[model samples]
Target: MKQNLWINGESVETENYRPLLNPYTGGQIAEVAEAAKEDVIRAIDSAAEAARGMAEMDAHKRADILRKVADYIQEDREECARLIAEESSKPLKAARAEVDRTVMTYTFASEEARRIQGDTIPMDAAPGGEGRIAYTVKEPLGVIAAITPFNFPMNLVAHKVGPAIAAGNTVVLKPASQTPLSAYKIASYFHRAGLPAGALNVVTGSGKNVGDALIADDRVKKVTFTGSPAVGKYIRENAGLKRVTLELGSNSALIVDEGTDLSKVMPRIVTGAFSNQGQVCISIQRIYVYETIAEDFVSQFVEEAGRLKVGDPLDEETDVAAMISAEDVERAQSWISDAVGNGAELVLGGESEQQVLKPTVLLNAKPTDKISCEEIFAPVVHINTFMDFDEAITEVNESQFGLQAGVYTNDLQKAFRAASNLHVGGVMINDIPTFRVDHMPYGGVKQSGTGREGIKYAVEEMTELKLVSFKLD
Candidate 1:
């Protein structure tokens, strides 16, 4: 297949192209147009010109277009999932789930398009002079720049682009270069849904070229990014007063307290830590088990993780697939080796074959260890024993990332305490940190990210509030 940049409602091919490779097979899947700095500028300018047209669209009409796009996605769900799996090396089942989630995201955006409302202030009750009335209206922030990651390409892109369109903002999307096929597919669906021309542009290229140009451009009003902390920090520093929403990296933690049922939590633990080869931002990286159940948890967890089928991502039964590239697999393997060298015990798989790395389990990893302190972004997790619940919470909070954390316990008070005490953005009770629905106010605190993403919350971020006040003549 040959894909080109989607600009101004047209598929435009450049003289330069990059071969899209399938990480699982190490084969060329397609060729995508390599967008240069000039292409990025053109996309931004097209979006700027279309911004007023998008803003003038009626809310119900916008909702209809989004709903139609969701329908188009559902109609071609299997093909879209296949494209995602082929491009991103995500397993077929996970890719299907991502497509389903993308559908839900657009559906939620459609519903939220009509619900974007602001509050009415009681001017008389606020010590203001009598016979005055005031109300606020939410208005779109012109053009949006959405930079998405490779993992969950469909859903993450939907998280940004769906909300931007719903909020009446034209978009210039810069999808991850490794997996631009899904983004191109999504843009096609938007076009088929009768969205106005030039409303959404997809530019595929390197971050330094396309991404930086988009961020630096004044025409792009709001920037929503999901990537590493270093790049997120760069965007934050250089975005120059533009409304920015960053969903950065995380080394998420999960705590298993005493008296919890291992049967109920073990499956979630495996799925959370190993799904998509653990490339998710909120993938469980650190597990803190109470000493009472530490041995049993580790044994059973390792057993389950070992049972995961690792092979081609196209296979329906494959539980784990290759990383985005061979380089990522090498880095992940090095982290595992480094942790073991630092006195950590490797109780399970720590091997890599080409782009595929085995789901690894480590015990007694020090707090300073690379796997413990940093976002591994691989199928590797470390388990440490904690005697006290508060200590576990403290240990989980010791990192710079404060994204999402999980606690498994039946004790209501302990659950509430963990919920309050954990320094993360969200605490999942009796569930994994990877559990995220489409419509929640999902974001992190501190370096993890800024602002929230869920359909409604993102619409709020993509808009500005204008107050209208009236006084009696």
Candidate 2:
């Protein structure tokens, strides 16, 4: 299949291309454009010109386009999901859900675009300011550079691109090098849905090269990125004066409090940790089980984890597919080995079992170790017991990377305190950290990077407040 890069609403193909590998088979899946430096400049120039004129476009026009984008996504649902699964190695079931999320994000952003209201000051009503009126209106931050990660390619693209476009800002997306095909298709779909030629552009190339070129360009007015903390900081330093929204890194921790039924909690935890091969930013990495029920929870979790089917993603019976590649599996195995070498117990599956890591579970794991501290981005959970709720919350919040977290507790007070004390973005009261419904404030605290995603919050972030003060003459 031929893959065309989308730029300025055109299906442009570069003379040069690079190989795309099938993670399950370790073979070339497709070839993508090694976009020329000149083409990159044209894309930047086009998006910048779009941004220049967008401030004058009516909000209703932008909303209408986003509505069209949503309709197109649903109309081409199956094909989009298939492409997502094929290119990103996401399980067929999971890929279908991602398509649904993509649709939801666009739809929500469309509705929210019409509701991007600003604040009105009461100066005119006040005695001393009878003739004066002051109010604030949100304006687009000009050109936005959307850099999405490999996992949930289409959905993340929707989260960034939908809000940027709905807020009347032109976008240039630099999708993950490993999984740009799905994103390229999204950009195409948006263009066909009647987005202006220069309003949205998609480029596929090296993270260090294309990403740097986009960030360093003065014309790009905003940068929205989702990646590792190391790269996020690098972008922040290099991207000067532009508005930045960084969604980076997550060693998401979950606390299973006492009094919750093990049967109910274990399955959710396993599915949350293993779904999408644990490539999700909010995937469960560390489990701080209450000491009272720690052993029982571990046993129940292990039993459930054993039943997860690890094999081909397209098969209806397959529960877990391959991890992006054999190399990622090896890296996960090495981390487990290093952890086990330091006395961590390998409970269920271990080593590279031909791209399927078999849902490994560790017991008595260390927090300082890579399995717990680092963003493994794999379906592996580290086990650790905590004495009480305070200790549990403390241990879970210790990591520098705080994205989303979960706690299973019947106590409302405990849940509320956990929400307040947990050093993360969103807290799940009775569910796993992986839970996301496409419209909540979705970003992280600390090394997990700055800024908020989700339709409404992202629209708010995509906009700039312009305070207009006027006096009646």
Candidate 3:
């Protein structure tokens, strides 16, 4: 298979190409066009030039285009899922879900396109505004640069590109080199959906080459990135005056409060921890169980985790597949070993075959261990017991990440307390932190990230507010 760069609404070949390998098999699935800095600059220029047409386009027309994109994705749902599984190592089931979410993301963006509006200001409330009227309107921010990660390649790209287009902004997107096929396919869908030429471009290559070029260019107006904290921080530092929305790393934690029915939520908990081999930004990495139920929770959790089928991503029964690379597997192994050496007990799994690290669970890991404190980004979760709810909240808040936290408590006061006091962007009352729909305001605080990503919220970010006032002559 060959995947070329999509620039100016056409497939373009490059002199240099990179082999894209399947994470599970390490087989070359496709040869992707490698974008040089020059290619990236071209994409930037195309998007900048296209911005005027996109901004002049009517809102309903933009909405219709998005709806058509959603329909096209729906028509190619299976192929999209297959590409995602082959490229990113997401299990077929999860890949299908991601594709579904991508469809909904575009759908939501379409709905938001028609709904974009600003509030009328009460000009008469001012002392000298007796015969004056004022209101605000949202206008496009011209060209936007989107940098996406390997995990959930289709849906995360949808989260960025859908809203950017809905807000009438042209996009220059640089997808992760490991998973550029999904982005290319999505761009093709947009082209078929009647999106104007150059409204969206996909450049595939090293981040330093493509991403830096996009960030440094003066034509790009906003940069929305989803990836590691280190790279996100670098983009924040170097993006200059361009608006930035970063969705970065997290070690999301879930609390099992006392008297909770463990049977009902155990399945969700396991899925949250092990899904996508724990590559998701909000995958559960830490669990704070109440002391009264810690023993039962650990035992039941281990038993259920053992049932997860770990093998080929294409297998329908496969629940856990390979991580993105062998290096990530090695890093996870080292972190597990460090935690075990620091007095953490490896209860269920601490092994790997190739890039697939078995679902791992740790008990009584120290708060300072890398596995406990950092975003492990592996199928390894550390379990800690807390006697008091406040203690659990404190432990969850101790980390530098403030993405999302979950609490499985039936008590109203406790649930509200967690909602109010947990220093995270979102607090789930009875569900795991990994629960996210396509249209909710989703982003984080602290080291997790900045800005929001739900379609409506992202449109707000991609657009500029202009005040329109009128005075009686």
Indicate the worst ten consecutive residues by lDDT in candidate 3. Answer: 347-356
Residue by residue across 109-129, what tens digits does model 3's lDDT show? Answer: 999999999999998897998
1-473: candidate 1 lDDT, tens digit per residue = 88989999999887789888899888999988988899989898889999999999999999999999999999998999999999998999999999999999999999999999989888888665579988999999999999999998999999999999999999999999898989988999899889998999999988888989988898888899999999999999999989999999899999999999997779889999999999999999999999989989988998899899998999999999999988888888888889999999999889888688999999999999899998999999999998889999999999999999999988999999999999988899999999899999899998899899999899989999999999976
By TM-score, highest first, what's the ranking? 3, 1, 2
The segments of candidate 3 whose C-alpha lies over 4 angstroms from its true place after superposition are none
Residue 172 error, candidate 3, Å: 0.3
**Residue-level lDDT for 281 in candidate 3:** 90
> What global local distance difference test value does model 3 have?
0.93
Evaluation by lDDT, superior candidate among 1 and 3 = 3
Pairs of colliding residues, candidate 1:
none
lDDT of each: 0.92, 0.85, 0.93
Candidate 2: residue 101 Cα off by (Å): 0.8
Deviation (Å) of 128 in candidate 3? 1.2
lDDT of 2 by residue, 1-473 (tens): 56667777888898888889877766787878877776777889889888866667787888888888888889988888877776777888888889888888989988887888889898857678888889999988888899998888899999999889888899888898888888877777777777788888888888766888898899888899998899999999989888889999798988888888888667788999899888889999898888889889888999998898888777666778888877788899899999999899998888556587778899987777899889999989988987779889999888888889999899899999999999888898899999999999999989999999888888888888998888887
Per-candidate clashes come to 0, 0, 0
Model 3: per-residue Cα lDDT at residue 105: 95
